[model samples]
Target: MTNHFPLTAKRSLELLGLIAIFGVLYIAKDIIMPVLMAFFISIMLLPIYRFLRKKKVPESLSIILPIILVALFIALIVWFFSNQIGILVKDFPQIKSNVSQHINNLSDWISRITHYNDKEQKAFIQGKSDDLMNMGTKLAGGAALTLSGVFVFIGLLPIYIYLMLFYKDILLRFIFMWFKTDHHPKVKDAIYETESIIKSYLIGLLIQITYMTILLGGILMIIGIKHALLIGVIFAILNLIPYVGALIGNIIGVLLTLTSSQELWPVITVLGVIALVQFLDNNILMPRIVGSKVKINALFAILGVFIGGSVAGVSGMFLALPIIAVLKIIFDRTEMFKQWGVLLGDERPAKSPMGFASFRKKKPVAVKSGTEKEE
Candidate 1:
């Protein structure tokens, strides 16, 4: 026989309180995202801060130098890309003409294959042509909006970064102080794990991005792709979104190649290069760097990316994996959260092979047979 008890009123109230908290967070997401971004960026740069301090750099200078360098690097990229974009804008009429030609060619090909009349094909393509033009306009507008936001975020970022760096110690202490005395060990362990995960993830990501940029840029240039630098930079930036990013980059490259040149070889070359880079990233770079650091499975990673994209757009997608990693770290360190941690991690909770071996050795089993009476 089994007995069961209903949840007490206090337990029900606690569950409702949690739901209320989540509802509030959902509503206040916009305000929260910027602050969360600041915190993550600060965490990523903390190692540089420590390195500078170790070299006897002043606290203020240590904090300021990394932030300044990062800001300048971002500024240079923006400036270079802005000039390239200006050229593209100036050549927009030619691009549109090229696109229209491509569309016509595609329609003609479709007509031949399907045995449709030229007039019907033309009518169908006209609708598609309008859609393409509208989409191009929207993309350009979105890019402008994104760039404007970047500048604003950059201008405000240093202040938040500095504050985090300056008060890092106080912040840690404050967080730990929330727990009771008996829980200090657990809290400290959680903090340590969180730091390890964040540091590993950020550094690994930066290295991977740089590697991809150089590899992709060289390949594009070798394939005689126009605006190779721009394409490379775009791919590298988008590649931060994990699984879907490389696919998007490849699609964009193929479309651009197809539109600009009628040469099938160039398009094939572009596709090949992207595939090779993706292979290398997945087999070599990602496994050695990111995989070791973040133990999240592909399913959770994809879910995180989608949820993050919904909440915070591309920036949210970039933040998603690290956020999940941090949460996994915290959950792993908490007794009540072990199940969540196990769900988040890729590894099974089964005992290690060595442990089983040792246990077997310690408690060896006796074999019995009809002819083994001497034993």
Candidate 2:
């Protein structure tokens, strides 16, 4: 009994330590989130950084080159969205008319289906107008805060990336120093696997974004949907965040369709198209591209997304999967945490059905126990 006491105490302490770590993560999210983002970004940019270094580019220039390219890519997306917004503004009058017509159509349907007349509906909405106004004011304030945070996050991100890149060797040495000389090989293997998985996942996502945007935007354009390209690009990017982002994308696509079209069919069409795209992405595309690389179960992925969002908003949600993957790698390599790695892993496989004929053939025959023993 005494032999087990120390082991139990150790595990209890470990649990409390883990709880403390998460608490600190939640409390210090403002700083930690940006650093984590930079870490992941640096990992993704490592190949490019190495390529440039191989060409004998200066260290600082190699680091700066990828950041500049990323910045330009972001700027291009912003320019595209700004252009789309301008088009939306130009067509606002028509949109307003269509919305008004839709509202009237809705009211007529309501009157036909229920006892609530148009006057009662108007009165009901009028009563909530002040509440809606207050909600809008709160939303605007939140938006301002979010915008400021985004700018600060963006500013810190590149500097953090550069510093991480600059100290890569030191960091590698520090990691090695944590373990004994005999364990270096295992540590190196873990690091190599972690890097490979993250690289594959990130590259897969980039390809997903490109192909999804083209497929969705092209289809919508063929079907005569306005702002089809914008919706496609927006949804494709948002869908990268997993479950929550896809829901938000659906809402945005439907709202855009509603505002732009007088007929109800386009809204339904947009919803259907988004659903089909999501199905294809999840079952066919993701398996082929990401394909058991991260090996995260659907349950943990969804929970991580929600928990991460609660802790650190959008960045947290976006970082959740890769971070979990990295953690699993570390855990699987460590003797103490291999059980946790197993718990986090996707280990299930399809089972074949039982064959009745085989079972019948293998069935035991009845015999007298004494006679069989004598024989």
Whole-model lDDT values for every prediction: 0.78, 0.86
Cα-lDDT of candidate 2: 0.86
Error of 2 at 167 (Å): 0.7
Q: Count backbone clashes in candidate 2.
A: 0
Question: Residue 57 deviation, candidate 2, in Å?
Answer: 1.4
Candidate 1 local lDDT, 177-252, one digit each (tens): 8889999988888787778778778878788878888998888887678767777777787888878787798787
The model with the greatest lDDT is: 2
Q: Top TM-score: which candidate number? A: 2
Clashing pairs in 1: none
Q: What's the TM-score of each model vs. the native?
A: 0.83, 0.89
C-alpha root-mean-square deviation, each candidate: 7.6, 8.6
**Residue 284, candidate 2: C-alpha displacement in angstroms:** 2.8
Error of 2 at 272 (Å): 2.6
For candidate 1, the per-residue lDDT at 285 reads: 82
TM-score of 1: 0.83
Off by over 4 Å in 1: 1-22, 131-151, 349-375
